[model samples]
Target: MTSVGIDFGTTNSVVAHFAAGSPAVLSSDEPPADWAGLGFDRVLPTVFGRGLDDRPIFGWQAKQRPGSLAAVKRLLRAEERAEVDGIEYSVEEIATLIFGHLKRSGAAQGVGFDQAVVTIPANSRGIARYRTKLAAGMAGVQVQALINEPTAAAMSYSMRSATEETLMVVDWGGGTLDVTILRNVEGVFMEQASKGIQKLGGLDFDSALARLVLDTVSDSDRWTQDERTGFRLDVERAKIQLSELEEVSVPLPGGQYRRITRPMYEQVIQSQVHRVREPIEQCLKDLGGSASDIDALVLVGGTCKTPLIRRFVADAVGLSPAPGIDPMTAVAEGAAVASAILGGDLDDRDFFVSTEHALGTKVLNPNVGLVFSELIPRNHKLPARATETFTPVRDFQDQLQVEVVEGDPEKPLDDDDNVVLKEWTITLPEPRAFGEISIDLTYSYDVDGILHVHGEDSLGNVVLDEAVSYGASVDKRELTRIAQRVSRTLDEDRIAGPPGPSASSLSAADRQLVNDVQAKILPFIDDAEATQLRSAVTRLEGGDASAAAELQAATRQYSYLL
Candidate 1:
């Protein structure tokens, strides 16, 4: 089986693989002509929008579709089920769609991959990580390992860097800011400390620019959804342009423009720049080493390309980031490096992986009467096992149920709707009075970060060990079904070649329809009413006349939110 590495990002996703003893990033050979504005060849945006068939359109095809779900990686942690075309798709299912896209894109380049090493943020909690695993399975691929984003990047750095050095990676990406301190010791990437702000990243910078653009416009609330999308796209493009040039102009809807100089852009985002400095300071503290201890500074993520960010990082870390690293694709490339290690294609040193979350079980507290008992702490090296024995309350316990959770055992999930990561109830073959029996709860966190638990009756010699079933998660049988279904779907895609223009793509006639509908609906609907309008536009692309009906009904529904 060919080994690949997938970097499923918050904004853009990519895949890399080891080919003929060398690692390389993969892109599409010829994207379908119909997917004109979508699928940008090298990077696939983590976006999905409702299509003409009502199934969600993905990748670049979803880009022009108003209300397309972008920044979905960040949103996955907050959501469980999404209403997609009136059919609810679990976050894992949504992620699977993107993964399938990557897999197919790689397949197009003649690589038949059955295994991969996927990377996630270092600070990803249990549920999010679980969903990612399910997603890979859903895409019909076996995940060799789920590595940390920075850790994977460190692997890539180790290959190119000739000397052993204490390195710091400031991963300022679209969804989060992760600061990792590690070392390249004799070709092994050793992690020292990992710290991150999950919610802070390029989106904030875009929002800042968006706010400035909105300020420039009069009666911004009356702007159409297309206008809003146009403005956001322009801001993002100009932000990239400002990196290379001193100034760039953002074209407004009505032939107007918002001129942005690099200095002005820096001024607007200075607060964010200052905010990023916190993690670096904290990373140093965690490492118990000064900035001088960092022999090399490496920048990853597209946001790091900005001059302001580069300058801030230099000042914060007291060293310039080493050149020759391509910030945009380094994480994915590093993932390829890690994938090589797992596939046994390359073995320079042993790679030690760790858990991203703490694993523990809930029980009665001695003082509080009811509390959570932690079995293991976060970042504990994988293939680790923790065993502890506890006594039941009564003479012979008929059965015992223990709620195993991630994070601090003392702390429950912030949301009441969210449940503990794992919970199990083991029944004794014979009814034993509570106090007489001892329950040995053993937790084995495997190399993949999967938690396995077993309860053994010390005297009875009966043990029940099973995989923890979390909410909306599939069992092994269901995983097989999903894998089969995904395999069939991907095979069809491979046979069909590239898809043509989708319902999500906006045509010239569709623009006319949007204009006509917006005029009729805006008087009653004060907001852009993005979803309904986009869906209506999708319907029109599918040859539905009187799309105005969709706009009118949607306008009424959206007006309440205003």
Candidate 2:
């Protein structure tokens, strides 16, 4: 059984595992022919797109395809489903595809694995964590446990030394910013606190730069989908280049160019960079410490590579990123180490993680309706159990409804940030007056991060006890069906020969127009119309002349929107 660790990131993903008693990141043995100028072959781009065959294409192959989905982890935070090329897929299904790629990629490097310890952002709610695990399971990858990204990075950095230091990790990735404060003592790693700002990261910087480019370039209103995609790629590249160079010229359509200086880039993203300080301040507050008390600051994430961010961290913490840590791969490396620890390979070390959010139940109050009552407060040490006693507000209450929620304890019950993980109905043995009977609600969070809740009456009669489920549970049958479909898709990808020429004689420009039209109208049109358009696009890709005519008709019908 090979112990594996997977970092399914927002912008890129990596797979690593233990090799010869040390963590090793896996990479493809042979690079693709078109790998030139793209990112390192080891890091897979988190993207999805439709191929010419109308099937999904992933990773770098999806980069050129118009309308490809990128940075989709942000979508998984709040969405249950997403549409790709007129095909609706559950968010978990999309994640399954990514995991499947990592699984195969790892195998190609002679590290075949079926299970892994996956990393997630420290601020992830119960629903997102559940979906991540569900996706991994659907991909035939058993997730042994979930670890926080910042904690994993800190562990990876700390494992190299036996220093007893207070470390703060500032993990600003593509989609989120997480800050963790902890102490590494001897071989035991204990987390003190964690705070984060969601939906604020590298992608936001890219968007801001893209806006700057569009505002400077002329005829921006007439840009097509392909041009827009090309410009987006260019903006991302220039953002990276700006990190090294003081300025770079971003090429525009029609042989034009726009110059972007580092100062301008920094100004545009200054607000986001400032938001990073909030989590750090909050974490310090939770720790009851100041920046002067920290021994070192560990910076991990591609976004942290920007010079401006480094300067900001140095100015804020009065320290540089801990020496010798690869910002891009630290989290994955840490995950591999954690995989070893969880697999019982590291008996000398005691690794402990803390709860990211407060876990409790909603209680009715006379003044504020339903309010959150904390059972296990945020940053509490894990493998923890807490019991809170409650009495019915009404006389002769027949049953107790336990609304298990997770969120900031300061938030109101109706606040959208407060997520209800599960709800339970405990039938009372007999109707009793509110003041006469009391029920004890107990919550236990295990080391594996699973939560269980139970209740009992004053008479010691067990009312309800079960593992608390987070999010809406998908039927096992549905999961199996999706898994079968995914298997068939992978099989087809393996055995299918090279693609044949299209049946239609439409020129390249005509085909692109039809694609643009389809992309333009799919959202506004009805499902029936969308289906017709999808069929036309598939036929057009297959060189169907009649289908080109059908696409032309639909294009004419929806020209108003276009």
lDDT of each: 0.70, 0.78
TM-score of 2: 0.80
**Model 1 misplacement above 4 A:** 28-41, 54-56, 75-78, 85-87, 361-374, 395-401, 408-420, 423-431, 459-464, 468-485, 492-562
Per-residue lDDT tens digits for candidate 1, residues 330-432, read: 8888888888887788888546666545677666657667555667865567778999886767765677776777664445544332237755566776656
Which residue segments of model 2 deviate by more than 4 Å? Answer: 28-39, 389-401, 411-417, 422-440, 455-472, 491-562
lDDT of 1 at 261: 85
Q: What TM-score, computed on C-alpha atoms, does each candidate reach?
A: 0.77, 0.80
| Number of the top TM-score candidate | 2
- Residue pairs with backbone overlap in model 2: 502-543, 503-542, 503-543, 504-543, 504-544
306-414 per-residue lDDT for model 2 (tens digits) = 9999989878888877888878788988888888888888666656888888998888788868789888999988888999887887999988777888888897777
